[model samples]
Target: MEQLARLEDLPTRYVADLTQKNLVPLWPSLRNVLPPLKPIPHTQAISWKFKDIKPLLIEAGELTPIEKAERRVLVLANPGHGLENMRATSVIYLGMQLLLPKEWAPAHRHTPNAVRLIVEGEKAYTTVEGEKCPMSHGDLILTPSGLWHEHGHDGDEPVIWLDVLDLPLVYYMEASYVEGGECQPVTNTGTKSRYGKGLVPTQHHIRAKNNYPMLRYPWAEAKQLLNDLAEAQSQGPIQVAYVNPETGEDCQKIIGYSAVMVRANETIQMSPCSAAQVFHVIEGQLELQIGTDTFNLEKADTACAPCFAQVDLINKSSEPCFIFIADEAPIQKKLDLYSVRERN
Candidate 1:
């Protein structure tokens, strides 16, 4: 393909007129926005080690109180898009939030959909839409868009969780904002008990009330499922998606979550897709290879890959490796831009 003409090729006076009149030619930048084969994503393959993040989070806790800081969090910003943007990928926002013992994060709701993957400690609970969901290592809790939620810790140790949100996309659309409110009266326990694997409350047939039927996915269940899948299948990566029990759709509308288990000393080559993806290790260790870049991720470590990048995950430990993944597939599919390329 021939190179497109540069803006500098035009006469100075003509360029000046175009700039003065706020009119610009498209030829000079056409190839940029419409690259020949694939999108040029700014998201980079980057990893944040929990060891490096934990101290900063502890310092953040000591520096700012819950009242002053509201929700004290250290963002895991990807440098490819610039650190100021505070995004892990093009659409996902990642943060390590800390809640000290006996602390309470005030109740508020925002337009951006959010989920919490509990990283450490216990007795920490997130109340979403009046349902109190307990936090445990590797558990996933949803605080979807427009739902009031807050955090409270009852344990003796500091509680930490990885917060994944679709804030970048929502903010880019100029639709992100939050409303503060007083503590909510605990109206219900987590809805996870009411539903089982391939089962839902019988009442759902009569009439569905809550937009989000389940607010929490216990890690124990997901882990067991992965083990079962590994035992049932002799080949392929063992994975399970977190979805709405009632509709069997992605749990949230914008971002999708899933758990992947890599057998001991196994390697899995993920299909190249158009949407950026984030991989977080929940247990064991793994080596993540994106294109030519590689990262060794340990428990609680997180990594992000750019769109359409070739990704390979290898279990570095003798024990099985469990991972949590977040991606923009839901929104991409909704926008009709989701695609997977076949390897030659």
Candidate 2:
């Protein structure tokens, strides 16, 4: 009976031990340590080339069927986090998608603005408002908020591209929309060869591009100018990146965002302004300093600087970095000054 009592006491001890295990405290919040940054030089930074994507597409072809259907995106930012078969992880939901031959992604549309940077393939087109933009290598197509678009590739090879847009922000607002073209064919039926609709039925050149009116930015020409600038600098430690013309920079007519690039290892101090700005990096890395917070940036990452903060950026890598900065440009006038921030 004494032994049995001792064994029964052991059971109570075990219960007490289990109760003690539940007292673990919650972990502290993890904070991101920001680094010092400066304004990037635009000219030299634009010259930095994004990595070629053809190899990744080719590698996808070599994978097994299961892996082939899987996503093979190599993030321009967060190179470590490869989202295979899962939605991409970016400030925006964008990806460098590679589609195998005969793979047709159905038509869809949403409220958030979207754009596709065509990397390869021909004969496939994305129809927008009765006009089709050929998804050729190096071409950029727009799918503005609420616009319905679909992809149709009839060629013999895979088509790939870098898709960028503000998806997460829209989702956060609980304003997501989706529509398909399965029942209704694209507005462009058989007249697929009419890529040169020229004006897209617009009235004036200013109204054509919509952001100060320019047709076909002609990447070849832009690349040429950047290349020449790089030669002048001898591929120096920094490049002076300029704000994109379409970004509505100092343009009085447009109501959209604007941005420019800064060379890697370069520095820039932003002029103060009341308009808030968001910077998205497409290539290379950067460290930005806004007010007292320092953000170490990687490609495909974005940082927002409130209207009150005096902002500046620096390229931390030896290589060139490309960044797209967006803010509500002043439509009334061009602001040239040292301070763009105003205290409330």
Candidate 3:
């Protein structure tokens, strides 16, 4: 019997044959279609999560305006960088968040501990729980898991900060809740200067030794400290460490809470480490490569590199740039830092 048909008839018959045989040819419909992107396999039990936002811009195209207006966000988890979605537990979230001079994202709250490393800003504050915490350039603030916070700008220019949260983990736990502020620019219950100020000596558990009654990290002091430290390490890699204001200890926002220092054109080959690393570039530019993808992160950019991703850094600017980074740090301390030549 002749079952021959024209080309248009071939596809339907092929699908029918596949269905009958419990198999799928897929080639015809998939010839010009894309295969789903696969998440890379981890060697050990641990995994890594890092991204290249530039190539992602090229691949995904510009972010739509509605997206920008809703959350005031300009990027998404792109396939080019292996970010599955906000609900992907093993993934990390990173982006360049631009907040205008008068932009005030009304108060909202959620679970999953988060941190912010200010990229550039002077007169901004994120009132957490109920207290307003003043923000300065390069300051790091913590909004512990499940806390309500709001952002307001009273400064003269646009204020921007990096926002990081444990996305999928929060979703997986079924503990993520987001509620808008009571009203536009809802005022806090108490000001950071009034309640959390260093002047007050009421709460011991929440207060670090350096915990001033003030709810702010001053930039004037931070900038000077970096300048002095860089001058000392001028011939080599520079480091301006951030100790807890209250305890003068490392890893206060959990573990590996500190800012980093990098000079122009300097390249750092991060040693094999176990911490889930996060970075916000406060100044200068950097070239970050994970596997085959590369990222050129500039001021105001942020990244969260999970523990397993082998990492490398290349400085492309002319002056020193400070980088704000937080991570679990090398669990064993043996592979926390390394040289690029060694990685190569």
| Candidate 3 TM-score, true structure as reference | 0.60
lDDT of 1 by residue, 1-344 (tens): 79989999999999999999999999999988899999989999999999999999999999999999999999999999999999999899999999999999999999999999999999999998789999999999999999999999999999999999999999999999999999999988684666765357675474358778878999999999999989999899899999988788999999999999999989999999998999999999999999999999999999999998999999867899999999999999999999999854
Every candidate's lDDT: 0.93, 0.50, 0.55
Q: Point to the candidate with the largest lDDT.
A: 1
Worst ten in a row by lDDT for model 1: 198-207
Cα lDDT of candidate 1 equals: 0.93
Candidate 3 residue-pair clash tally: 13
- Write one digit per residue (lDDT tens) for candidate 3, span 258-293: 556677777776764545566666777777766555
Best by TM-score: 1
True-vs-predicted CA distance for residue 147, candidate 2, Å: 3.0
- TM-score for each model: 0.97, 0.46, 0.60
Q: In model 2, which regions exceed 4 Å deviation?
A: 1-101, 117-125, 134-139, 152-176, 183-221, 224-259, 272-278, 283-285, 290-310, 316-320, 328-339, 342-344
- In model 3, what is the error at residue 118, expressed in angstroms? 3.1
By summed lDDT, which 10 consecutive residues of candidate 3 come out lowest?
Answer: 41-50
